[model samples]
Target: MPYFKPFKMIILGFDGVLGSVLSGALDLFSFTGVSWQRFSNESVEPRFNVQIASLGGGDIRCSNRLIMQAHCDIRDVTECDLLLVPTIGDSIDKVLKQNSELLPHLVRLANTKADIASNCSGAFFLAKAGLLDHKIATTHWAMPISLRQIFHWWTYKKISL
Candidate 1:
């Protein structure tokens, strides 16, 4: 068998992360490989390899109260092509407080060669990690304007630069 490197994409898992977003993205990426070819009656290889990672490297509960056993933890992942942040379940402040420990891991991952992307409230984590500094970004539609102000206030120097 020929060994070809596939694009590695890691999805960040957290306590309040929406299960749908995580599973939805996982399923979408899963379909990209040879499975799509079989599903479509054509021959094609998957371009991406996906994995779900959490802080403790264990099962995580979503905002909808679903338990998801992550494939691994942030500590287990040395590097990847991309890191995807999913939607958060609660108020921005609450979620950020609950996930404060994730900042360092996210920061380390962001500093790597891997690209970082997020959906909805997930952008907060990326921003808190300093990945969004000086980058144009947006968050979940439901987020209030005040949240943006708070973020701007917190990272005033970085964003201004």
Candidate 2:
């Protein structure tokens, strides 16, 4: 098999989910590429090609009024070597009710062997696609009980954020 060069890291974003984790990872690593994407209402919006230009400057606001910014989109993700899903909110019920279309694409991406990483409540998306079944995972401590209650077959570990 031919070895492919590692290119950009793609960060998936919703309206409220922050993109800092993805951006920080890029800054910490010597990646040849990095980018982000917003998957809104069953459609994907490709943003700018990520350069050092997009970091340490802007702010993006989360649904909970948290501010964050300075991230690129998936169109900038060519030959993606890593993908990050940042923590969103605690309401899994609300996310499913609102972002139902997000899962099928997530499942498709996972099936294609994308290196999927999630933090905090981002696990909810994985769970929705049945990806967390029989796998060890972590989430915010306050929500583990509810997560376990909903995903009975999966083990949820409490982790400090």
Candidate 3:
């Protein structure tokens, strides 16, 4: 059999993140090529090397007050196949204000071969990074107006949760 390297997946971790969205994203990607193989009694060849990356490689305090540990520092991540930004559960303004440091990294990674994705209000990070400029983007249906108001340069498609 030919050797296969796992795809690197980095999930951005920060305070004010939604607990469910963060854990759900982690579970979904981490189990991609491993779980079903186990259930079918096949060889387990995991597909992704998933990691939760925070600003300082420290603990993350979710909006729900759950504390979670990050796998690495976001500043140290030079490359990845995919970078996920989970839903922001707290006040979007407050969260953005507190995690401003992530913007530059987002822009840097966006320039790489990484596919950047976000859930709900997390798209604000991508927008703030100037990635969505003149590009089509979307968010939770209820937030289209809010996002549009803040990011008038991009076109938004409303998606219902």
Candidate 4:
């Protein structure tokens, strides 16, 4: 294996985002080394440095009324190897408008060429930030029509089994 530093992942936690999604990403990434040892009988150092953040930090109230505590604000994040944008609830348009505060920070991070991933409604954030321009992106099934209507630069391909 190549010598490497831990990958820094800054997960953006926002108001009205699904609390489960944030926790799911955290739990999955936080214990990668432990999981490997447990399942593979080999010990290795953890590879990811994960931080859950918001626009201004503090409490992030979700659409389901679940409040998650963020470690810091996006402004405090100086370097990011990966940035995961969690989804807001049903109204991607409303959430995008209300959370415009995160745009500048996101744009700066994108300019750094960090890998950015968005979940469901979070794709709208990427689109609005122009991060998804000329990039392929997929959103929740219920919202793909709207996503396509608003952000035509990205090609969304639907697959059926």
Q: Please give the CA lDDT of all the candidate structures.
A: 0.81, 0.57, 0.90, 0.84
Which clashing pairs does model 2 show?
Answer: 8-33, 36-72, 36-73, 36-74, 59-68, 60-68, 60-69
Higher-TM-score candidate of 1 and 2: 1
The lDDT, on a scale of 0 to 1, for candidate 3 is 0.90
Question: Which candidate's lDDT is highest?
Answer: 3
Score candidate 4 by TM-score against the native.
0.87
C-alpha TM-scores of all predictions: 0.85, 0.60, 0.93, 0.87
Least lDDT summed over 10 consecutive residues: which range in candidate 2? 47-56
- Clashes, model 2: 7
Least accurate stretch of 10 residues (summed lDDT) in model 4? 87-96
Q: Which of 1 and 2 is the better model by lDDT?
A: 1
Candidate 3 local Cα displacement, residue 102, angstroms: 0.6
Q: Which ten residues in a row have the lowest lDDT in candidate 3?
A: 151-160
Clashes of 3: 0
Task: Residues 1-161, candidate 4: write the lDDT tens digits.
Answer: 62568889999988878888888889888887768766887656677889998977878888888888999889898879999998777477777877899999899998885888998878889889988878777888888788878876656677897
Which segments of model 4 are wrong by more than 4 Å?
1-3, 38-44, 152-155
Separately for all candidates shown, the number of backbone clashes (residues 3 or more apart, or on different chains) is 1, 7, 0, 0
Residues 1-161 of candidate 2 have per-residue lDDT tens digits of: 22343344555655456445544544544422222222234233222223321222344445666555545533333344455666775356875556665566666667665677677887877887788888887777777887888777866555558
